[model samples]
Every structure is written in structure tokens, then in C-alpha cells.
Target chain A: MEWIRFFITAALLIMGMISFISAVIGVYRFGFVMNRMHAAGIGDTLGLLCVVSAMAVASGLNMDTLKLLFLIFFMWFTSPVSTHFLSQVEYYTNRERARFMTFRKGGEPRES
Target chain B: MNIDQAYHLLFMGALIIFAVLIGIMLIRAVIGPRITDRILSINMIGTMTICSIAILSGLLHEGYLTDVALIYAMLSFVAVLILAVMYIPAKSTRGQKQSRPEMADTAKEKKLQQSQSGETTRQKARKKGKKA
Candidate 1:
């Protein structure tokens, strides 16, 4: 029925918004750059999936649904790469990272 | 309520929530301690914007907005990539003989061997600790 479809779509959309809300709170509350990134990753992935799936459900079978799917797929592929690059930049740029992290000359983790 | 009315209410609520989240993210971008944090916030805001746009596509019955969302995704990825590239130091930027990690480790070892006459005791201890 139309009511069933609408309820399903509404539920999915609300669920996605909840995840986004939590992710934003995490981004705000976390102390360090890596911590904030971990929070943001949730929004990039799970939140996006939920929201897009809601859209797909509401739109039904169409070229637009296909486009939404592609958008989700592309985001999944690129999000990790961006996260990796961000970590690399953090590693190379932060001279004071050793204060928070340990890097040994060999195999061991040097205590800071 | 009719299906259209329910759907309209859903989208209106979603858009409002997304707007609030985007505003919070803008605050995060402004207060973020580092460049990476700012980039990360921007990346998240882009994603939320894409969500709203997709929702709007359904609400407005405009199929083209979905295409716009796809394009936005690609552009956001490129923005993050370009910004990340800017932060990564070039090979020649340090003016060091070491090209990579292995070479840099060896160079550190070599420097460990050649202690100068004016080297302080703390510096010597630091070098010895590094060699271990």
C-alpha cells in the first residue's frame, strides 16, 4: 500500500538523520584530529547509505534511483581514500605527533 | 494523512535537521585546531549537503538534482585530495639526503656515529637512545 511505502521511507530517513546527528556530536566532542575523523567517517558511510536508500525507496524504479545508487557507490569508494590521505597529511605535517604517539627507529614503539 | 502530505512532512523535517547539522559542522570547521580538521569538517558538510539535495530531488520531483548530487560527490573528493596534496611535503622540501623511510633510518644511524667535539651530553644520550 501507499501508506506502507511512505512509512518505510520515513523510517529510513529519520534513522539516517539520527546517525548524522550523533556523528556531528562526535565531531564536536572528540579531542584530537584522529578522533574527530573517526566520528566523521560514520556520517560519510552509514549516514549516507541510510539517507540514499531512503531516497531510492521513495523514488521507486527509475533512472534517478540508478543515479542515487551510483552516488552512494562512488562515495563508498572515495571516502576511504580521502581518509587515508588525511591521515598521511597528519603524519607528515605534525612535528609534535611524537608527544602523542611513539615511533621507534626499528620494530619497537618508542615511549614518548 | 495522504501519502503526499506525509512525504512532504518527512522531507521538511529532514531538511531542517540537515540544516542544523550543517551549521554545527561549520562551527567545527571554524574552531578546528588543524588544517586536516577543517578539511574533515568540510568533507562531512559536503556529504550532508548531498543528502539534502537528494531529499530535495524526491520532494521537488526534479530528477536532475540526483545528477547534481553525483557531481557534488566527485567534486568533494577532488577537493579533499587537492587539499591533502598541499599538506604533504615534497621530496625536496626538507633538503635532506634521505629519500624515503629506509634511507632516512640509515641516515639517522650514520649521524649517530659522528658525534662532534661540541656535542652536549643530553644530545649524546638522545642519539644513543635513538640507535636502540
Candidate 2:
């Protein structure tokens, strides 16, 4: 039983770390900030989810597990909001942003 | 072989991998071409750090570290939010237009696809035949 649990935990944790690795590689490879954000955000959400859930499983249904779940929920909420704000900053600040993306000539700010 | 021993080994491996990833992200932050790139890398690094802390809480059998992870999440979020919001009003106030070039490409693709419907294809074929 213990070995089964360890294997499960190991699989999840390693996968999560792999996601983070890919994300970092993406950050280095992508040419544009928005494209990089797209990569980083997925890694953030998925990697955190994988690792934390593995921790929770190892913890075996207790108060600590509950807290871990809360941490995930909090991260899920914050990640997107932060990304939104970051992209808004990107949109408004990148003077040549037009070179990377295409949009209407003029319109109300579309929700990112 | 034993459960505790196996878990300990796994946890140590995870911690080491995360540290390397975080280091790479740090380098990305350092050499990032734009402010957004730097911040994006920072956000990713913070996220990976939080995961490391969570794993440490499990490995060290410390309840407090769990709480610490929770707090770190909030702090990281606030940091990114502040950095992002700081740039908004100052930049957007200039009435400058920033287009989504990818969107424009997609729109152009859609137009091209629309113009290439079956009837349009047949019409082009007919025109070609007539020319021949």
C-alpha cells in the first residue's frame, strides 16, 4: 500500500516538475511577451495543481490536505487576474505591439 | 524500500528539479527583452517556489510550512498585481492604439476561407475553363 502511494506521488510530482521545466524553456524560447505568458500561465496552473494534489494524496485526507486544496483554489483565482493585469500592461506599454498581434484599428479595450 | 525512505527520496528529487527550473526562470527574468517578459518570468518563478514550499511542508512534516505556502501565494499575487497595475494608467492614457496582430491574421484567414466556398471554387473552375 505504501509503495503504491509512493509511486503515485512520485509520478505526479515528477510530471509537475516536467511541466515547470517546459514552461521555463518556453519563457526562454518565445520571442514575444504575450506568447511567453501563454506558456508560463499554463505551466503555473498545471504544475501547481499536479504537485499540490500529490502532496494532498500523500497527506491522506486531513486538515492539511484541506489547506493544500485551499492553496490551489487561491492560486487558480490569482493566476488569471495577475496574467490579465500583466497583459494589459503589455498591451498598453509595448509601443510596437502591433507587430506581434492583430486587432481592430480602434475599438474599446477587449477583455484579455 | 520502505515507504518513508521512498517518499523522502522522491521529495528530494522534486526539490532539486524545481530549484533548477526556478534558476532558469530567474535567468529569463534577468535577460527578458521587455518588462512584461521579466514580470512573466518572475510570476512563473514565484509559482514554482510556492510549489517547492508546499512540497517541503510535506517532506519536513511541518504544518507551519503549509501556512507559509498559503501566505506566499498571496504575496506573489500582490506583487504581480502591483507591477501590472502600475503600468496601466500611465501607458493607456496616451490614446495609442495597440493591435492584436495575431487576431488580424486570423481575421484575414477567415476572410480567405469565406471567399473560397464550394460555389466560389466552382465559379473559379468555370472561369478557368472558359479562358481555356
Docking class of 1: medium
Model 2 per-residue lDDT tens digits across residues A1-112: 8778878888998888888888887777888988888889878799999999999988887789999999999999999999999988887676665467664422224623
Worst 10 residues of 2 chain B by lDDT: B101-110
In order, what are the TM-scores of chain A for the candidates? 0.90, 0.92
Off by over 4 Å in 2: A105-112, B90-132
Model 2, position A43, has a per-residue lDDT of 82
lDDT values for all models: 0.84, 0.81
Top lDDT: which candidate number? Answer: 1
Predictions' DockQ, in order: 0.51, 0.41
Residue A95 displacement (Å), model 2? 1.0
- Per residue, candidate 2 scores C-alpha lDDT tens digits across B83-111 of 88887754332355654333122444335
Q: Tell me the native contact fraction for each prediction.
A: 0.75, 0.74
Q: Which stretches of candidate 1 lie over 4 Å from their true place?
A: A104-112, B91-97, B100-132
Worst 10 residues of 1 chain B by lDDT: B101-110
